[model samples]
Target: MSADPTLQVSVLLPVYNAGRYLPEALESILAQENICFECVAVDDGSTDDTADILNDFARRDARLRVLSRPNTGIVGALNDGLALCRAPYIARMDADDIARPARLARQAAYLDTHADCVGVGSWVDYLDPEGEHIWTWKMSANPAQIEHDLLEGGIGGLVHPAMMLRADAIRAVGGYQAECKDIEDYDLFLRLLEQGHFSVLPEPLLGYRQHPASINATSNRGARTAIANRLMAEARQQRGLPEKVLTPTPATPESSQLEWIDLALLDGNWRSARKTTCRLFRSVPLKTAPWQALGKLIQAALGKLRIRAGRIRQFVSIF
Candidate 1:
């Protein structure tokens, strides 16, 4: 398809078995304000109702386009979707997250004014599967800091689904690499940063859903880390920096326990979550993850109370 001169952005969404949250994700993109965009949703051979949901939404909205093909994993799906995007800017979105109405408009405007930045992302609110806000994940707006964090595998790196990329810059790098699989976004960001800067808007413009089935929860951490380290090493070599041994942080028993605690929270198993949180506190009082877990539990409890109270108010009003 030829590039649509009237469209300012293209939302590249790749889905596989994402039926449960597909509607909300599509709504978020379709409801975007102050931007002329098209949603190129690639359905990668989903056995579930993902294709049905995409078709239904496409029927309602002419801006939505669906592409169905046999499963070729995320890399293939992303590249195919990228090829079909007809806008100058391509906003990466997942089928399970919510984007604020101004997300695309704000990012597009930033890119329009700042010619140096090849992409821009925003901080995001971490949400549980039920869409309760857990905590706000803040990212650095400084380009240098973003680059440093990406290379060091530290915090503050751009969230893949929260990013808006210059289509040309992305295509110039040969798009997402198949070898980068789970860490394709990281690899792509590194390559793009080499060509131009990346910035993060200081606002939380996306609700990043975290669940037990999410990639971060289920992927092989060891293998993912090795790929990331190698990518960082390559980036440093390209910059002519001296090679340094990139050590992978050993996962402690407490960290593993903390993962279980987080999974329990995502599963809404409050009792198990509380039990694990207490155990972590007793076992590793000085550690930060346990304390963070405790805070999340407290927040979850408060959220539940608020929900229950609202139900009671509605019941009383019915009388």
Candidate 2:
């Protein structure tokens, strides 16, 4: 048995014609401090200079292992890397994203402290190609909360690139399901949540690069929708949850619009929320839509109050 109690996480990076961003991503992973990790770069037969980049990195560092295979999609490449990983933990990093230097070390420590957490991730900063900050994505810390929020919309709160999984637990879930090809990470996360809890560091651990040529930009929306449906069904079955539990509550147009207003309020986005609420109140007929219209007005007022309170708190804290 390896004497080191700290799990040696194998960083799995699947490269497919990612010559531009591969070097920086690999460099950041290798620069992690106070941690022992194996960087496995699986090149899925890139027609560009991706192979050369991988080869150069492999030759320079013993920790960097290159697996060159014929052209396969991201799902296949990830599965292949997982099979060859010898570590007890697996950390996934996208070829196009930049992982912070402390990402592995922090997640490793979190897992070590929390035995119940089978997987861990952190907030991600979305950046344009020129490295301009777009927005901050904050994920739910509570497992139940995350799952509940996911039912209403996307569960991609914990970005895939910043995710680290327990090797055995992942295998137990049958690895990534083939049916969820493009949305593989989403499917795996839902399954992982069913078996064990998740932890988010509450800080940006990865810089997600967004560009026009990115795969997600041109991905088949119809295929992803199909995969999402299957994922929901599997999660429900595995968790022994009732179909009604997963089913989204049918909301009237006014009521549904109110929900969006509520979300904006909670996130401190007041102007947009108030504007939307005002529009709904003016356009919607009061007698027929009394409950919804009233609810929107109440929520909108509360949103303004919340914003005022937040500003007051900030001002006091500064003093």
Candidate 3:
């Protein structure tokens, strides 16, 4: 816990098996200008080279401190980092995401000016695995708009990793609750909003990468709906707030499996493609997964044939 007395912010980055994109994430933070900060990166027992990567960065940058521990999961890693975050303001960063160079400096300035704002987050640019911009999560700028968005539509109204918050306020709310699980950020926001205002900066301060095995892919739609209902119920009963959970039609198991298969194809992971194909074959009532799997299988076979034919042609030419 090498915290600076003059540090205005401490960035809590909890890393798991994120060796692929860890360097880029850290470099982005190191690029920040005129920001007095410390990046408290807790390496939560990554099986990959994540520990080595974090240690290398920590050795180079005095502001970055790496804590290596056994795999206690995300909740444990977050709580550990939060406990050691010794700064007036605290920020969150993800191992697989890149923080904009100006992100830390701007958020720190905002908290300094806005005495009533307990936490502030910026809008995020969503990127595909190839790092191409897909879309943006444009969060509301003011507390009133954010609260309205949360209640009326059951949105947390804030991007989790792109936030800067008051350390004292977050500690007062008891850090992040483990029960929240997949929706921990929303739970934290609900608790913090009870204390003071939570708002978003208009700037795009983070680039979040999407992968097939990501949280967005693995999240249970049913669980999310339950959380939304719970939030709406609490709001109505306690604050007399009018809130509606606009539920989307749930994806069938077959369709969801097919979606994963397609994603696997796009990612060029044939093993995953074949694994998903087997599950789809076993699914009752039959569905699009079977048909999609057949097409993909044929395409792969044809691709292999093409390569073999090309190789034979070259060998014949040499003879």
- The full ranking of all candidates by TM-score, starting with the best, is 1, 3, 2
- Please name the candidate that would achieve the greatest lDDT relative to the true structure: 1
lDDT, residue 242, model 3: 64
User: What pairs collide in candidate 1?
Assistant: none
Question: What's the distance in Å from true for residue 145, model 2?
Answer: 1.3
Error of 2 at 24 (Å): 1.1
The CA lDDT of each predicted structure is: 0.87, 0.76, 0.80
- The better candidate by TM-score, 1 or 3, is 1
Tell me the tens digit of each residue's lDDT in model 3 across 1-319: 4545799989999999998989999999888888888889999989999999999998899989888899887878899998888888999999889899899999999988999999999988766555655456676787888876666645545888898999989889898887767777777777787778887888789997766557766678678668767866676557776655657546555655566556656655666667667656776435566877778778977987999999999999998
lDDT for model 2:
0.76
Candidate 3: residue pairs that collide: none
User: What would the per-residue lDDT of candidate 1 be over residues 81-173, giving only the tens digit for each residue?
Assistant: 999999999999999999999999999999999999999999998776667665576768999898877767653469999999999999999
TM-score of each: 0.81, 0.74, 0.76
Q: Quick one: ranking by lDDT, best first?
A: 1, 3, 2
